[model samples]
Target: MQLNAREETPVVSVWMITYNHEKFIRQSIESVLMQKTNFPIELVIGEDCSTDGTRKIIEELEQKYPQVIKPVYHKSNVGAARNAYEFCLPKLKGKYVACLEGDDYWMDPFKLQKQVDFLEANPDYILSFHDCKVVDRDNKVLKEGRLAENFKKDLPQESIILGSLIPTNTVLFRNRVITCPKEIFSVTNNDTFLFALLGQHGKAKFSNDVQPSAYRVHDGGIWSSIDNLEKRKSGLNTYEQLYKVIDSKYKHLIKKALFTRRLMLIKQNKSVLDSIKYYINSYNYFYFGNGMYKTWLKSHYDLLKQLYRN
Candidate 1:
């Protein structure tokens, strides 16, 4: 729908970041344009100098829907985290903000409206997100339900810090609820940090009742493109960074997550020194009350034996 000139301000701003997503950019943009909302919404895209035809498609769409589409064509590639945190976020001129990657698209036309309605009625909640269908590169549904099915209706900020429970494409949050830390731009998993930061201000709701969006898994996708080991390491780094900056109450959870990732890495590498170092690190980070010491000792002992045998 064409944005009315009378409605100078947008109620929702769709933040999209794209790089070499020529194959999926059109679908993603069209999905935002197709949203059925009573209030005006603007699409703010961060086109990070794609090496493909992605920019061309965005240009064509921007011209067609000039009122609803606002494009930030970067002269050079600044990576996804920087594009979102530094460029696109500052350009958002809406009460609420929703995120949609260039490779992912919203399936329901009322996606924005549903989340907006929920956030409007619930003042205590800072953000609301729904489930999403996991799809392959060819748009085949690999999973039919929520991205994180184990997630509950009332989400804790600690859970968000440990892992990604909410799908990025399905989230609609109150704009300017929290000032994003400069540390966020340095992390690989900026979205997780953003959600966790938002969670700190108030509460988060998981709208299972809302229609799910599409989360595409392709080789070109950022997180999907990485290998399992690299993904684990990335998560470990993000958790460590979060532990330093996040509130003191949430540090324990981040530490627990770190211990788990370190244990996994030690097992995979089978290094005796690494296992011993993990045991030492556990003592420094985790207290005796959490039973972390026992778990670390047992795991390291087994790893030490295996390493000797090898």
Candidate 2:
């Protein structure tokens, strides 16, 4: 059965999670409003109490665009993690969701339109994310392409199983992909964790054909933005936190981490395959990676033990 691109269009909730993003909120809001899709879009933004005029900005936009904008402004600053995960959960009422942070704006109006068209056509696939061009606070293009090369080939199921696949800003997840109840929203980037879990349950998809959105790499981004060192350091810290969250799968991650690190080394004209050969061989039931990770784990435990002893 051939699918008409527009007929089975899914309802996409444009989730704009904000904290202290007064400067970029306007562009972000405007971006959601600019979508050229046939499906309905619900803009659910949690205006975490911003010290700046961001809340007033949201209010002004809400006044101007009453129908599209649906905001739950916090009386007090509730922090980004909670404001986004907890406060924004109740507000979402769509078949699928497209997450764009308040600090970043979508460059293409057809971003949601194109993604829904692809997802509806491909029923087996769970989530779809487009490559983003890095942009700055002034909306200036910082880099012409992706932050780093992720999923060199078209996305594979095992890749989703093993690889790190949450580029949260550009991703769109179907309601079916997210099985967690309302309470799961409090789980960190619960949206992100759900998407990866979705891939585990079903097939994950990707589009390498075109760049459908502009992912702004401002200072306050979830991941490392090239412009800021402190935020980038925090980003790495956040990455490690997520790392420890997935610590049970530490063995598998040791393989994946080494694999990607080797891939990067291959790009850099250095020999990494030989260096990380022990970890890579662990996938063949060798557990060499486990041996290495255990050493590090033991060292960490021993350090903690010394603190306790003292």
Shift in Å, residue 223, candidate 2: 4.0
lDDT of 1 by residue, 77-98 (tens): 9988888878889889999999
- Give the number of the best model, judged by lDDT: 1
Global CA lDDT computed for model 1: 0.81
Q: What digit string (tens of lDDT, one per residue) describes model 2 on residues 84-118?
A: 66677656777888888888777776777777888
Which portions of model 1 miss their true places by more than 4 Å?
Answer: 146-148, 177-179, 289-294
Residue pairs in collision within model 1:
none
Q: What lDDT would each prediction earn against the true structure?
A: 0.81, 0.61
Q: What are the runs in model 2 whose C-alpha is more than 4 Å off? A: 1-10, 147-153, 177-192, 209-212, 225-310
How far off is residue 122 in model 1, in Å? 1.2
Clashes of each: 0, 0
